[model samples]
Target: MGAVTSSMAAKFAFFPPTPPSYTLEEDEETGKLAMSGVPRRENVDVVRIKTKRATDVVAVYIKNPSASLSVLYSHGNAADLAQLYELFSQLSIHLGVNVMGEAPMLPYIVVRQVK
Candidate 1:
């Protein structure tokens, strides 16, 4: 019964955006990753980290010059890193701290991990 309930829950739980909100592009000269349609910042970096689960997670790192601490922010399910880029930047500026925003993988990735 528990297994059946878990299966049903998994089937209905994830709803990643169909076309994806943004795409990652590598800068030819700098060899850095950036999100499409977002302004590139000198202090911000887009990175992909490989997890032990064999999945790659994309994260945005914002640097504040005077900041001594950092915040790891996980955005809501409804949004992706591109959608929250400005917010993360502003938060780092106002709070005077570095910010790292982690992006959620697509639904298919999550489903595959479950299996």
Candidate 2:
């Protein structure tokens, strides 16, 4: 029963874009990472962090020189980093705070039945 519920929930909770919204690229010379088709920003950095589950999660960090606070923005399951890149940048600039947006990992929520 729990398995069936989990399966149904999984279907509704995740909606990864087909073909993916963007691809990660690394500069051969500088070793810097960027998302394809997104304009490069000197204040923004693209990084990947390894989770305990061994999943690599992509995150975007936007820096503001006047920032006295930082925010960790976790987007909704239906959206990806590419979709919210502009918002994150704007927030960092207008709010004068650093913004870090963590991409959603569907596999991070794999449902397990308890014994």
Write down the RMSD of all candidates, one decimal each: 7.5, 9.6
Index of the highest-TM-score prediction = 2
Show the lowest summed lDDT stretch of 10 residues, model 2.
106-115
Candidate 1 per-residue C-alpha lDDT over 1-115 given as tens digits, one digit per residue, 9 for 90 to 100: 9999999986677545666667777666666777776898999998877789877777899999999999999753545787789999999999999999986665432211110
Residue 98 lDDT, candidate 1, scale 0-100: 100
Off by over 4 Å in 1: 1-14, 75-78, 107-115
Clashing pairs in 1: none
lDDT for 9 in candidate 2 is 93
The pairs that clash in candidate 2 are none
Model 2 per-residue lDDT tens digits across residues 1-115: 9999999998888866655567777777666778766789999998877889787678899999999999998754566777789999989988999999987544532222222
